[model samples]
Target: MSSINTNKKNTITWLLLLLFTVISVYIGEVLELFTTQKSLFIGAVLFIVFLKGQQIIDVFMELKYAPKLWRRLLLGYVILLPIIIGIIYLV
Candidate 1:
């Protein structure tokens, strides 16, 4: 029973990640947001990336039950990534 549930959850998570990737590509190419809304484009992409990172960490890595220090460190890394990317975009 547990195995089936876990498999289902993993499948859903994978699908969501794929959808996010498609959305990012659509934003970058189809929408051509970079030409006028560079900041918005970056913000949208970073937000999706952050969500994707959290999904991977919690679901795939199974880190939700891990020690507080370890979990926090991983989450902190995920949170920090967008900040770094945003800074790079600005530069």
Candidate 2:
């Protein structure tokens, strides 16, 4: 059924995201590969985690079915909010 296939796809995406999360954490923490590097690497990894989390929220959390404006607002809150705050703090 269509719903069944959709569920499978969602599951796979989540698994992939989980795998990436583990890799990112391991590389950033256990190996300490990111500590000495620019914030770029850690930021990128965290950004990927955020993106995956957003996708999961959109799909499994049913945010995707919302109105376009609401979705954009939600994404802005999730993505841009931190950057704005960080910049403010830095300044």
Off by over 4 Å in 1: 33-35
Per-residue lDDT over 12-80 for candidate 1, one digit per residue giving the tens place of the 0 to 100 score: 999999999999988878446347767778888888899999999998999888888887999899999
Point out the worst 10-residue segment of candidate 1 by lDDT: 30-39
Best-performing candidate as measured by lDDT:
1
Q: RMSD in angstroms, candidate 2?
A: 3.1
Q: RMSD in angstroms, candidate 1? A: 1.7
| lDDT, candidate 2, 68-88, per-residue tens | 887778777778865765456
Screening candidate 2 with a backbone cut-off below 3 angstroms (N, C-alpha, C), the clashing residue pairs are: none
- Shift of residue 62 alpha carbon in model 1, Å: 0.2
